[model samples]
Target chain A: MDQAELAAKFRNKDIKAFERIYSDYSDSLFGVIFGIVRDREIAEEVLQDVFFKAWDKAETYSAEKGRLFTWLLNISRNSAIDKTRSKGFKNKNKNSDSSFYVDILETRDKTEIDIDVNYIRSMLGRLKERCVKLIELLYFKGFTQKEVSEELDIPLGTVKTNNRNCISELRKLIQT
Target chain B: MNVEEYIASGILELYVAGVLSEEENRDVHAMILKHPEVREEIEQIEKAIVRHTAALAPGTVPSFEFIKTHTAGKQVPVRSLQSKKTYSWITYTGWAATIVLASGMFFMYYRINNLQQDIKRAGDQNIQLEQQISDVRKDAEATEELIEILRQKDIVTITLGGQAIAPESFARVFWNKKDEIAYVDVSGLPEPPEGKVYQVWSLKLDPLTPTSMGILDQYDSDNNKIFALANPNQSQAFGITLEPEGGSATPTMDQLYALGVVSAS
Candidate 1:
């Protein structure tokens, strides 16, 4: 079975299941939260809180509802947004700028990660500006199709097909 | 459903993002399960998003031990102080004249409370026994009334033979067409598997439509193993199938234990 399928069958109180899920999805989840919170320590704290919520509410998670990643993403986005609004996080970073995920990647120069920064940057350069904004708004910011349509001033119908094409391109890039 | 067209619609990406309405999400989820191509497409979209985000992860996660301890430790109940107290009242205390007097008074109070509780408990038990006797008598009267109803001249007896799945198990159905009631006897059938009960179906075999005629509950406790059910349909056949607890919407053909057809009356 795939990692998504395995992560859905968590034993609520089992530390082994919690450990396995943490190891599997924590990096992606941390990245998503970190993308929003933009602070390592605050993002990490939010990430921990997200998993604790997941562990406590394991019975509510089911494969039939949505993918395990989707479930965790929802939790991470809500928690990080809530953190950003809090007094502590507001004091640290007040400016919520217009930089998308692509901007975030361009600034980070970590070699230890499997991501070949220059190669991905060159490939992502081909992905349109609108595609990055759509992903950032939809995935990172948790905007609905209606909200995205209003934000981008594009027809709602185009938002869907454009995302499909952009993700397909990203899939090919990542697979290679 | 056109798999290619559906996959190209791009709702699966939104689905992976978890932004769709619950109803919309369920529709996409059902599509993923129904079509292998849809599931593959959804997995690919999710992988792309996960990988893209994971590439930008800030730093290494702390050791799993921190999370493990936090999650595991929080559920543990605090050891209440009451749990630690030793109730060994027989232990010796300081031997003083005042201590002896105090002990005598404490013993007298304990004995009075204990005797009073014992008397009250005995009275409660006697009342419970009397109530049980009355309940049994009521049950006997109900059974006698049922027997009388079954013995009426209008009652039509139908013997249901065991199906291939359970050849040893069979049941009898007594129907009163005028009253629109069917009395089912399941004494011959063995106990149903755990979490399963025998559901009776009133069927019309021309187009093969089945209507539920209630379930045969209390299979173990009934002395005669007979249950009365409402059968408002002009049933051509009677069937019993083992179903999950609370019964199923339709009869499970493989688990059909007994089936019998009504006479052409």
Candidate 2:
């Protein structure tokens, strides 16, 4: 089935749809969660919690609010961030790395990443450092448009447009 | 309205990030429905972000089975107490200590009754909720089993289309030749007339012979509507027909509701 049909089944609490959705989007969501948590086991725990909550709350999902990937991304970020703030996670990962996720392309080895690692690295290579940071903050960090503008020291008007331009650049790079 | 300008405004990017306000999100969704191009633009942007982020995914994450086994029937809904208690104490005392003592005892008796009633209601509700949970669990378990059975590579799936007697009625047979079993799914069939039941049959196309597999006795109660019938015949086709309550001695060609020949796999 197409994504729309799959999402309809998912909204109906179909377990098969959930399985297919897990296969389709779990990787990207895990990456977003992994970027925030920094610890593998905790990220895994948070990932599991995220899926559990997603399945439980699937009935409440409305297509008008957002696409499924964005919804899953939002849930992953919120869950991972919540995990990081929890006392258990803090005690477990006291010395965990706190580097920005924008540097993942340059820092993480290829073997540890996905098959499209080189493609993403090249895409990030082409993007300006600020562009990469903006995507990371806005997409992975769950930063609001206002928060993004504040963090980047740009006017509120520019963040949306600037992030737009950055994603457009990425889309172009992907096609070629 | 300029579609390209709306696409260029970058709100779609914010939309994908979920950073847009509720009203803004609604507007974006409306535009997406009104203009396919807007939807395409949003999809392209989402693809870029999904791919970019996915590239950083770990080489291995837990499998879907991890989710299945972990989350199965773990949700026990929190019950609402739904209690309404109103207190009323207007005492006219001839002697303060005696009045207070008497009122205190009266209040305790009344409070105990109210508490007992609440406890009883809560207990009944808990039983009902547990029954519902178990019923749902049974349905889910049965469905999971059927899905596993259907996923087997050796199962031959034959779609029995509606016949002239009931053009709208249909069924499916999952024939496992090695196991000598055929699962008949009769979800699409209409309710049979009173005193008549739908009987499954294994057919031999060359000789035009029919053998009664079994009647769907629990058709009304079966939520899954899948009946596993023991079929040890070297059958070439499968059919379902409305027959007498106990079934017929021979083929009921006139009553054939659905029929399909097993294709060469």
Candidate 3:
């Protein structure tokens, strides 16, 4: 089924539709959560929470707001951010090394699962450090353009154009 | 609105990021309906982001059954009631007493199980609370130390005002010139983007030479956003520039975030 049809069915509390949505989007959602939380166990818990929240709040979702995947992505990101802010999470990770999602990708254990790690690595490798950071903060970290500009110490006016250029670079890499 | 220009404006990227305001989102939504190319662009952005993020997923995901059970819809079972059959008063009383006795035992068992679970949950909660208390205490102690450093009598304070690029941004350098150490208060600066660090430069104005003091590598993790770096330069001024991670040998002029000259002390 198309995303719209699946979303509509999922909204109607159709179990099959929910299962299909979970199968299709759960991995990406989990990846986004894992990127933020950086712990497998915590990421799993947050992943479950994201889906449960989505299930409970399905009716509030509409295509007018955004795509179904984007809706789920927002939930996952918010939940993961909340997890990181929790006192328990803070205490546990106080001494942990600060690493971004790229680090996670680079250091992934290859024995367990099959993914095109080399493809990802090569695709990401083509972008400059600035582009990588921009993509990470804007797409993965959900930072606003102002925040991205402030974070990168780039001109506020140039953030949108810079990001557009970066994503364009990414598009070329993906296409090739 | 020109469709091509709107597409090139990067509003679609912001839309995918889910950071646009509701009005902007509605506008984009309207545009998507009106233009197939716009929808295609959004779809491609969404696809690229999804694939990129999905690559970072851990080796395993939660079991499907777990989600199924948790998100299962509530359903009320239907039951048909049959016509009541007349029974002797003594038989009905006996049956009622037996049922009451059985229910009493079952309730007691269920209560004990629930209480046990509650006790376990409370114990876990107490441990988490204790951890939180310790973390907060540590944070307070760190903040106190930072305040002490900021208040030192020998510290020479310089306010690094934001440049034309970031008018709202600012930072402070509390340098103990005698000790050759500078404490940077970077709270005013926004958190550094990934793969980027705010590199402080001890500058000489006459010669326009820049010496890298140190990179604020732990900018995000540093709760106070205050970092202490060794400054061995016979510096006339201080400047901070956002450099790529690991820092640049020389500050990128355009990326210079804040700058301030030392008072003739």
Per-model TM against the reference: 0.54, 0.54, 0.54
lDDT of each: 0.80, 0.81, 0.81
Clashing pairs in 3: none
Looking at model 3, give its docking quality level.
acceptable
Q: Candidate 1, what DockQ?
A: 0.25
- The residue pairs found clashing in candidate 2 are none
Error of 1 at A12 (Å): 4.5
Largest lDDT belongs to which candidate?
A: 3
Every prediction: chain A TM-score: 0.83, 0.84, 0.83
| Model 2, runs deviating above 4 Å | A91-117, B74-265
Per residue, candidate 1 scores C-alpha lDDT tens digits across A25-135 of 788888888788777778889999998788878888877678888999999999998998887665333334636544455445422233336654755587777887888
Q: List model 3 lDDT by residue over B118-236, tens digit each.
A: 88667545544654565587689899988888788889999999987787899999998788899999899877787989999999988799999999887756778889999978888
DockQ of each: 0.25, 0.25, 0.24
Tens-place lDDT digits, model 3, residues A109-159? 522434457766796668888888898888778886667867889755567
lDDT of 2 by residue, B161-200 (tens): 9999889889999998889889999988898888999999
Can you give the lDDT of residue B75 in candidate 2? 68
TM-score of chain B of each: 0.52, 0.62, 0.60
Residue range B1-265, candidate 1, lDDT tens digits: 3787688778899899988766667888788778888888887888788877776577787778877766767655678665565644454454465699999999999999999988866754554465456558768988889889999999999989999988988899999888998999998788898789999999999999999998766775567789989888999999999999999999999999999999897
